[model samples]
Target: MNDSDAINKYHLSVERADGQTDNLVVSEGHQQPEDVASTRLERVNLRNGGNVDYQEFALEQEMILKARGASKILQVCVMLPLEGAYSMITPEGEECHFTPNQGFMFRYIGEEVTFTLPGHQTVRSLGFCVSLDVFKRYLDNQIPDTIKPMLQPKEIGSLPVPFQIDNFMRETLDRNLQVEAQGSLKQIRWEGTALLCMALVEEKLHKAANPETFSLTQACKQKAEAALELLMADMQDPPCLADLAQELSITEKKLNLIFKSLYGDTVFEYLRSIRLNKAKNLIEQTNMAMKEIAWTVGYNHSTNFSKAFTRQFNITPANFAKKARKLTKVS
Candidate 1:
């Protein structure tokens, strides 16, 4: 759709090869009377009856958006706002706020909801809609019967922002939206991504439902935190997991469990993250040599450090430093 000075509004209709249509109405750069503005819409439909819709809205001033719609099919909606917080009011007057990384899951059954955004802010959201049968088939009866109630119509489920999954989801959506593709290839990509998204959500919900997977108590959390502090304080030459667990007065298995529960990473993975982050900062901010930086982060040799750094950040230390310096100079 072309941006036009005379056209105050644009309605774009996208027909997917899978026989789905997207009707989008976007603003023409000028703020609306309600002070809410939508820049554009990106939508993809899959052959499996799932669809992904993305929109970026900017608020020139504070306003409330009243959206009323009914669904002809039973579907699950997963929504994530990439920027700014917004309060949502359901038709029944139920209200909640959503932020970045945090998401809302609901089995939407034709209910209207209003979203309110503050002034001078932008909000980007990715929404996934999958028919009930498709969603259940993907789960393969893994979800417990107790949690099944959350899948009832109008029942909303809250997710605690699985960061790794969110990062992957956002990157996948952004890449697919930016790339120029048509028909079957685009539909295939969207289908694969939608499945992956559902897999991540299922894994998270499964973990939450399984008692053995998450049983960390307050005491266990404190012990895990203590272990983490020790790991960070002595990253150059940290103790092994067994010895650390010994120091914390917990069994190694318990140590591993609680650490993973509290920090979302294993003990060694946590150390690696700390090591890499410190190395990245040193590479960017300081004039430290590669070998020195490697040794500082507990890697005995620069090659191993380079491999780990590249595995984590997808950039070699030298290249990262070079780019950092170049960007710094330009700035």
Candidate 2:
């Protein structure tokens, strides 16, 4: 069979965008509903190639593949690790391990593989079946044919990415699933899928250049994360840049750069945004007067609060509060 036909015969197709197509099929061994659901769970012993077992435990998992049959295109499998490791055999026949904070992807055609799980691991995984046509459309517009091969099943296999990507994915999915606003859910879902695709492409490219750079040191990452947590703990009494730098035991300039690098905003800007958001929440959810809500969020002057709120939300505080109340009453 031709390569295209070979891909079609094996994996299911799922839609990635409005006009784009991609196909994904779980290994036939994973076709059973119970089996699929079992894989969705976080902690499972997965044996991929040899007799040696790899225990896979994730906080959450999601898979998106194109539709199945003649129209199939791309397949995406996401396994989010919560607190354990899983083993898999790479396309190069190398045995590799993945931690709970890591993920892997497999792209292939006519390749048979098995994922075995022990009965004790309890984890959640999400699977997406997408269509190839969607990916073709995306490729036609955004990807070149030379790179197109890279996106094909066999060309790219088992790319690993950071756990932050999984958190973003889960947040996007949960938001899309719970959103009740008209047209918002689909918009978010589509955006989420696009982000997932972009992440996959980035992983492939990164690995091609440097295969050894995927893992993050848990201790260092935790230290950076803890510093961020401390900075965010008190929005109203937000720390000055100097104070924050001292708390984190870094120079002020270094702290500013790090905050910007990690969060795409300066510490002061991030804190201001947080305070504004809190003010907004108070306005919408509580019976506090506008001035009191403003004070609660570190804004002492109602006028200054109104100006900041207007700049941030594109509406005056009073107006926003009024609209929120109206919407709540209508609901």
Candidate 3:
């Protein structure tokens, strides 16, 4: 079969699509009933003829990946929550919230996990799956001695603390997601990106003197999370920073710091990023007019929206929509 057909056949399988919203569901071990909301997925087979797979998914909603019914043998799950919050729940009931721009490393041999995403907004995430042998082979020389032991195949009670996704890391991952290649070249590109991402994760995790295990007080965590939800809910006209702080009964300075600490960006930066991503999705998934889409996303003028879209993605709204339509046809 051709490359596109091959990708469709092996790269992804959607159990069901929500007619109203674009959703591609993936469950643990490829089992039924587990839902993962994603609009795009690419599965790449290793070039060395290995059984390992390098996969990426762009999620659109919060989903629950059940652990009890999983069928596949998962060695390591390297996760990047590009745009939304995530909760990783262990079988023992230990749960932690992962903020945006944080990388999660999950070893799933002896442990069972249920991953849940936010239900309100779109969450773009990238995941890499590898066998235990494959993981050790690739990182044996690269990983430092101190962190090497953690890589050993074993189950633990708690999930490893997440690390920051710095500017350089963000650029690399974003570029990889936008890769446009065909056939063997596509596979090679994916493999290289996966290794690079893995290396980044290791480097960041190693440098962290103390990983954040979500030790924040339960009340504070819930309140801070509620603040995030409020901001995300209204993209066109979100609450002012001071108003948000007052609503949460916190100082503006403290609120800003909390957002920056949890997510790697300020409140303004995060909101702008979310808005641009929403615009991109609308361009790709809907046939709405530019003016209407702009207004819907909270941009008062089409020109302003186009300018922002161009600045963020380096593509004009019209051009992006045209290309998206073409790709939809080709796929």
Candidate 4:
């Protein structure tokens, strides 16, 4: 169909919970429609007012997207809650599943194929589409050819981002949408696109099925150590594995493995040790109440903290504090 005909055939609009209004214009037959697609390539703030519920599917359908035959490269940014299972089979026959708290990427080369969103499960997601040519110009050959395949016929899933990164990306997208209403910033848009692509490629490369993984390398170990130190450095807000994993750009499973191999304890156990050690120092130096000390050591309930303390130090927190006081007084 001609551009005018294609435009007439397809109805492109900005849809929100309250209503739908015309925002995006794609001439029908200009491109094959995507199974699920969203973007604000022209207007930035186009996504500022849309709410889509958790989608669940018992069965999957074929997913395909045909962009207008324009030789423009497209970058699609998607954000979804990591709480359910999602799988994608690439045109090349590679199939994979991503568990909760993870995200993946898929690239297309204007081919038509079946894209499926399984039923009976719910996830909240936001997808941003960009022209591929724009992306190529932005990276200027810094993007590896090996990585270029990611932009076409590839499936990425089950990778988690640090909460900070997740929040940053979400906020950036939101802000871009808002700014787009005022005007489009091509540089800023390109930067956002680049960041998303870098994150996707970095996550994939780190988690590749190889023995010499990124997290296992010495440099990565040092980086992890620095991150762990920062996390424990603030005893008041001790970090959780999930939070730390996001910051480190590795999965919780891999973090556990690395911590066990290097520190001889899982991340949880290590935090407990830190808390216990702090409690011991407090017991020796101060005549604080057990409950008070427990609170100071990152525990809300004294009873549970005391049990954990005893398990680690071979004595109740109260008794340890008493003995510690006596030792200090005598000394």
Better of 1 and 4 by TM-score: 1
Best by TM-score: 1
Which candidate leads the pack in lDDT?
A: 1
Q: Deviation in angstroms for 71 in model 3?
A: 5.9
Clashes of each: 0, 65, 1, 31
Residue runs of model 1 more than 4 Å from their true location after superposition = 1-38, 58-60, 141-143, 150-180, 211-331
Tens digit of per-residue lDDT, candidate 2, span 1-331: 5534433234443222233433344332223323233332111111221010111222123322322233223443334433333454544465444443344443433343333222223332333322344444544556532244435554565343233333344445435434443355544444454445445544544544543322334543454576668756765576676776677676676554555556655566666678889888887788799888888878778887775675455456777788898888898
**Can you list the residue pairs that collide in candidate 3?**
236-298
Candidate 3 segments whose C-alpha is farther than 4 A from its true place: 1-38, 47-62, 67-74, 110-112, 153-159, 210-331
TM-scores of the models, in the order given: 0.53, 0.36, 0.50, 0.36
Per-residue CA lDDT of candidate 3, range 108-213, in tens? Answer: 5434466665444444566665655677777875655544554654545334556777656866777776788777777677778778888888778775754434
Q: Where does candidate 1 have its weakest 10-residue lDDT segment?
A: 1-10
Candidate 3: what lDDT? 0.61
Candidate scoring better on TM-score of 1 and 3: 1
Q: By summed lDDT, which 10 consecutive residues of candidate 4 come out lowest?
A: 45-54
* C-alpha local distance difference test of each model: 0.62, 0.46, 0.61, 0.47
Candidates 1 and 2 compared: the better one by lDDT is: 1
